[model samples]
Target: MHKVSVIIPVYNVEKYICECLESVMAQTLSTGIECILVDDRGNDASMEAARKCIAGYSGPIKFQLVVRAENGGLSAARNTGINNAKGEYVYFLDSDDIITPDCLNLLVERASEYPDAEIVCGDFQTFPQKDVHKLISLQGKNFPESSFDKSWIRSVFLSSFPVIAWNKLIRTDFIRRNNLYFREGILHEDDHWHAQAYRHVSGLAFVNKVTYLYRMRPGSITMSDGVEERRLENMTLIFSEMFAKEVEWDKPWSDWILKSVGSLRYIGNKANIKEKAEHCVSQLLPTVYKNQSAPFILRLLFKYYFHNGVIFSSRLFYKLYAIYWKYKG
Candidate 1:
């Protein structure tokens, strides 16, 4: 079997697709890898561009291209690739992001050292963006080191990192055995999947060296107007799904959802979606109460907003605080 199946879900990323593919082709690791490029019905010349880049490729790895008939979203594209993967391990690569030459090599080495590991992750740097730089402190630049657990992930997820498919390599047998696939038609599908995946993980590997480059484009969904509402709705859905599962009730996970809603409220009001912001809070507060052991600070924030009708004020505070930070930075 192939060692790794690098799945790249292609959309309309004509600008960066070539560079992204090249980075994979240049990987120093000569392991059995399958580069499966799934084209999700793009209008642009992205397919043509991808074809040109792959024509001269003569690496040890096998390469294949797939073109889907319908324009399913990112989750569907990824699921398609995963369903067809012929490797012992899988790594999902965003069409627009680029990986370092040694990323696969490092991850494979780490996973080999810990053969029982279901997942292995490495550090990644955001390709120089103005506001993105402000969000991350220089002191926090070191790679993350932690024992993998639901609570550990819940705490780390609070910092608003992109804990999506890109930075990790997953064991294919575990995924297939568990029938784990991205939740179709959900905006933040990764959040939901990771919660469950983290629970089932018998072993995990964290490499504090090497890196991937996540390019920030202005038109990305995170930078769009509709994202605020979608995120709020998505978190509500995720929290409900988590509770319904057979796992133990997770207080930290509940707290994380509240924080997500709180952050959404802050961004929604700034985006002038006050009514929608209130709607999200209403859906989220009941779940917050289920966590009887929640910390006082979070409970207080929830009580003040829900009981005192302080959501509007809460929203305003975030807006002003963001403006101040923008000016100060």
Candidate 2:
């Protein structure tokens, strides 16, 4: 079996597939790595583009193109790749992103160092089309210097959102053993899957340098306006799972709720979400209260309205909130 399987879920990224494929093929490591490309029912000549992209590369790498008949969302595409992965370690890369030549080498090195660790993560750089690149670090507390524990992981996860799966190199067998997979149909599936994965993980390792380069497009889903609602719904789904299984409550749980409240406020600013946003935010508020993270003062802000009162008084609540903020400012 290959040492690492690099899975790329392709949709309509015909413009950037070439560079993405080249980056994988150009890995500095001589270690055996298989590249699995899943085409999720794209009409943008993605199939032909993929074939041409990997045509001339001859290395220890093996490549396969999986074309699904129907158009599944990103989660399903990734799950399909996960199911077909035939390597000891599984690494996920988006079709539009590029990796450094040492990306595979670094992951393999980290995994070898922490042989017992199920997941190994490295830092990545995000480059917007017209703006300078920024490094998005996932190495908050689980890096080479620190020892891993539940609390450390909880803090590390709370430091930022785990939307980019490219920084992680996960063990395939461990995933199968734990029955871990992405949540299909969720906009931010990574948050839920990674949250659950970190719970059972024995250890985590990180590389200091940038290994992956994420090219930010103007209209990417990460930059979309509709993401806030979907993200809130996904977080609600995740917290429900955590509570259902009786996972131990901790400060990070409260922190996550705080982050969700900020997200609700953000969604409240969108004109398109004016109609249903309040109900959605109301649904999310109960979970936030269940965590009891909000300060007493913040909780009092919603005191006039009962726990579920926002569901009925959503429009008025939003209007009053707007007027209050407008004058308060």
TM-score of each model, paired residue for residue = 0.81, 0.80
Candidate 2 lDDT (Cα, 0 to 1): 0.71
Q: Which pairs in model 1 have colliding backbones?
A: none
Which candidate should be chosen as best, given lDDT against the real structure?
1
Give candidates' CA RMSD values in order: 7.4, 6.3
Model 2 residue 158 distance off true place after TM-score fit, in angstroms: 2.9
Residue 139's lDDT within candidate 1 is 28
Candidate 1 global Cα RMSD: 7.4
Minimal lDDT window, size 10, model 2: 288-297
lDDT for position 202 in model 2: 70
* lDDT per residue as tens, model 2, 1-329: 88898999998888889989999989998767999999899879877888987888878789998877788878888888889999999999998998999998988998888777777777776786544233246544335432467667667565453445676888999888988888787776776776677567776677777788888886677777567667656656665565445555576755555555545444554535534545555454444344333353154346534443343355656654554444343
